[model samples]
Target: MQFADAKERVLSLHQQLQEHNTRYYVLDDPIISDAEYDRLMQELIQLETSFPELQTADSPTQRVGAEPLPFFEKVEHTSRMLSLSNAFNREDLMEFDQRIKKATGLDQITYVCELKIDGLAVSIRYQDGIYSLGATRGDGQIGENITQNVKTIRSLPLKLATPINLEVRGEAYLPKKEFERINKQRADNGEPLFANPRNAAAGSLRQLDPKLAAQRALDLFIYGMDGSSEVYTTHQETFRAIKKLGLKVNPEWKVATSIDEVWEYIEHWQLERSKLGYEIDGIVIKVDDYALRTKLGFTAKSPRWAIAYKFPAEEAISILEDIELRVGRTGVITPTAILKPVVLAGTTVKRASLHNEDIIREKGLLLGDHVVVKKAGDIIPEVVSVITKERTGEEVAFHMPTHCPECNSELVRLEGEVALRCINPACAAQIREGIIHFVSRGAMNIERLGEKVVILLYEHKLVSSVADLYYLQKEDLLALPRMGEKSVDNILSSIEKSKGNSLERLLFGLGIRFVGSKGAKMIAEHFGTMDAIVHASEEDLLAVEEVGPKMATSIVTYFKKPEVKELLSRLQGANVNMTYKGPKIVHANDSDHRFAGKVFVITGTLESMSRQEAAEKLEQLGAKVSNSVSKKTDFLLAGEKAGSKLKKAQELGVTILDETAFLAEIER
Candidate 1:
């Protein structure tokens, strides 16, 4: 084709792709099939490759991402992207409205209530009707530049409807279904599962390769303009203008004339938010009129004109049928409440952990009693409280069993411990649980080896210990029920692959009492090898940072077991990794590292990285990272809306560092 013909074709493809993207992503209406869209995209790529001069920065082909970046450059936000103060109940909302009314001197005020998307906050700048830059809200003022990743969001138009130079703020999110899809794939690959959609979105956006972010099917909802201007008189009008500029805006916003109307809107969404395509944590109420917002100006941290009303944890009432006892790998006997199937937090929860005998006693829980069940932030479902008013005479008070449910061994509550533990090493339940834990996602991460298969192996006597997992023969596995040749092959492949996991994973998988993943990592890095850690005395274990007296004792006690020693030897015989494989552990004695040897704890919502990421960075610098604020904690890295840890650190005389200070220390 001629150069002019190619140019025209490229332009046409760009227009077509943009329109289709808007129709599918923004309007949720598609006139063409996904195959047709892909065909158009392929044609555009071909044209761009054939005639390189015809390609522009604003071309639809750019949405596929550019080269991987070495590191993200920092960009200063035009306006500080402050976090909102939260209101948990109607009284808090009333107080907020009263405060606004007092400030603006109005009896009743108009406010716009929008869904508080559970996503990463981001901003995009458009110059002369072209998308110029995109960034995270790092420390409110400065942020990591993610222009390439932002450009990949097909919902974001590369060029505006008009030649307007302005900045827009939005929430970048992964749709719920897409989050599920990605997590399912990750699970199948034995990768760690994302905790939530918000986490998945944040992880995707922070990828070094923009192509990875593009593949996540991420989207954005433009909410606000960076600065107040005469261009739009009201907040709602700005949404209209944003839509007119070909930007996607969330359509579920409502204008409330009174605080009661605002409360009504919040009430409606509190029950309906889960039905939406993306996650919504709460509702944000903002002054609609721009002049009123100007009059009722900013606080030190957030705008006084707006308040976020956070939704409470979803709860459902279910009748407790019976209390069952469970044995952990550590032999801890935990009581689980079996409830009548009730849909709670988008899942049918039939079982909830009663936690311990003490909890049961404290709550006066009884079988046949109605209980309030809730998920502890989508992690575990637990019985929150017993509905005393719903109780009848037929309710039976639960008591802890004297003997282990599986082995019929006497259970004992160890010194200074609330948990009732079965000390029987030969317990069948303990062995099965241990093997299951060893292959779990955060441990050795053996893919496709689920709980049922572990139980099956145990029942058939095909495996008695976690070490047996590494030595599983294909013939034995193939002989098991429901085990196809393909299934057995994949399981064996995963088992073989897990032999090279870092020492920390193996340590955690051993189910040592009081030794968590972080503690395992610290111990592994400090000792450098499994042999060193296995033979280390309590004094040697104490040398490692984050190892408290109790933890040191637990490690010594766990390693002292003859069976554990034998298991370690068998694992060694199978050629499992016996040394730390993460970033080289630095020396605290090094002169240039000020944070070295210090104990740091982190809390709240960090804009740049997750808590785990920050902890790993600190560990690399030879600083001990703890999860709680204690007297030994040297610094508390507090982020947005820092809670009890921040207060506890202050009370304990621990030094505090903000996100900026923490980042500076790490960078150094």
Candidate 2:
């Protein structure tokens, strides 16, 4: 076929497949059979393969097998992706209600309850109703741009029926069926499988090439808007507007008049969630009145007018078929409960964490006992309670071993801690886990080195300590399975590149006890370099803000280890960047007049500026840009239909401003 003719044919096939996908997957009303859709896709692939030069980035055949990128470029979000405060139990929900009432001075309030999807949060930008950009909520301030991949989602409207400029926030998720299918394919290909749908979604979205992201069969639901040419006063109205624009919105959302009704909505979904094809971790409850939402205000990270009511971990009765113990990287031995296969929270539960001896003793779990198992955060499985009433007298009581399962070293429980430690530095399990942690994304972010590669290196004895990784030769790596010359070269390059990462990343990579990313950054900032950090007294460490006595002791103890010192010396010899510089430090004190004392609550996506940039600008003008609407809020910066907060702000009679108005106010 001629190149132009093939291109035309491919475009037609793509449109047809998109329509079929929307009908089958999004609308749950298929007009065509799976076999027919497959045939159409196959034809498009054939045509694209024949005329490769004619294939466009948006073509359906380009979803997979794109060359890996060097790195993901940073995309600044027009609006900050604020997270919701969690309400663990009924009491917490009640407290949230009480706080809202006190702040808004209202006798009662309405709430909009929607399922909190256990997936990746994404923002899709549309210009004149045409899909423009899609980004992940990276650090709430910046995200990776993935517009071409997002366009492949058939449910997402590439071009809206109405010509409107807007930004919509939604959860990009892999359905259970799709996740299973992809994992099965990976297993067949001898590749590592994703642990869960959330991981799969995250991995797919972060693929630097849009073609790889497009092939993931990802789906989305529009839940919030940032800025829109059209106006929406309430959360419900916003949903309607999004639906009117031919975007997918969750049908399960409901408006509640009181907290009890909100609880009811949550309870109803807790039972119904399993029936749905997708995964939802909890229910998000938000104040319905935009004006009232403004009056209720926001905290630094989350909003006071909203809370996520997570369901208690989904539990299922399973027989304690066997008991096993595994030693962790920290030398702590964890008891695992091997169960008779039972489905829980949409996945099959085969094992649950016993945590430690205290938990086993507290629960009185025994072999052959029918026990209640659950997945904590829909990820880690744990035994919640034992159905002891059904336990047969023949069931045996299990005891934790006194020796490390991997190293056979004597386990010792510390003075105050419940966990028993193996203290054996050379334990195979500990070495493997430590190496994995050292290369983790939040740590050194070693590219082309996943957990599987780390384990392979450990098994082959190519790497024993974290320092050994830096010394590995391309030939040494090339000897491993699936490691060709090209792959080995890539891995070596990534390892070399990681050596220049900031000091904060190195500190976190060390896996120091009680030291997280934030704490590591603080320590790096205060100490300036690794040498200073190692030499600093515990008292000096403690003097740093947010670093308490426990953390101080941990830092001192971690550096005191001769092995750790050796690793640091090797890293230094390799010319690794060991000093902390700091983040892109932008000061908001640049200006101070127009926005003084004016509280602005920004919602939805902005066009030219990121949420952080806008917030910084507002702050520079002496304005307080809060996450939620509250009584102190003088203006509700409505982007698109700004959700329930917008409605609450309206009900409370707070002044509303679109992005243009907000920008104008800031300019003044």
What is the per-residue lDDT of model 2 for residues 1-668, given as tens digits with 9 covering 90 to 100? Answer: 88777877877886787677667756889998889888998898888777777666545555444565665555778877777767778899999889888887788888899988877789888787666788866546666677656666667766565787788899988888889999999999999877678768767776767677777888888888885423656788888888877788988899999999988888788788879887887899877766666666677666777888877866788999998887777888888899999977556878888889999989988889999887754357888888878966999989888888888889899998999999988889998998899898778999789999999999899999888888998878888998889888889999999988889889998889899765787688778899999999999998875599999998898899998888899988887889985552222354356566578887766776866567656655656667777778877766532444654464344666666656766676
Q: lDDT per model, in order? A: 0.86, 0.78
Residue 444 displacement (Å), model 2: 16
Candidate 1: segments with Cα more than 4 A from true spot: 32-39, 187-192, 316-364, 368-370, 378-381, 387-395, 400-600, 603-663, 666-668
- Model 1 is weakest, by summed lDDT over 10 consecutive residues, at 644-653
What are the models' TM-scores? 0.63, 0.58
lDDT of model number 1: 0.86
Model 1, range 401-491, lDDT digits (tens) per residue?
8999999999999999899999998999988898898889878889879999999999999899989998999999999999999999999
| Lowest lDDT 10-residue stretch of candidate 2 | 583-592
Tell how far residue 444 is off in model 1, in angstroms.
Answer: 22
Candidate 2 TM-score, C-alpha based = 0.58
Native-referenced Cα lDDT, model 2? 0.78
For candidate 1, give the lDDT of residue 136. Answer: 82
Model 1 quality (TM-score): 0.63
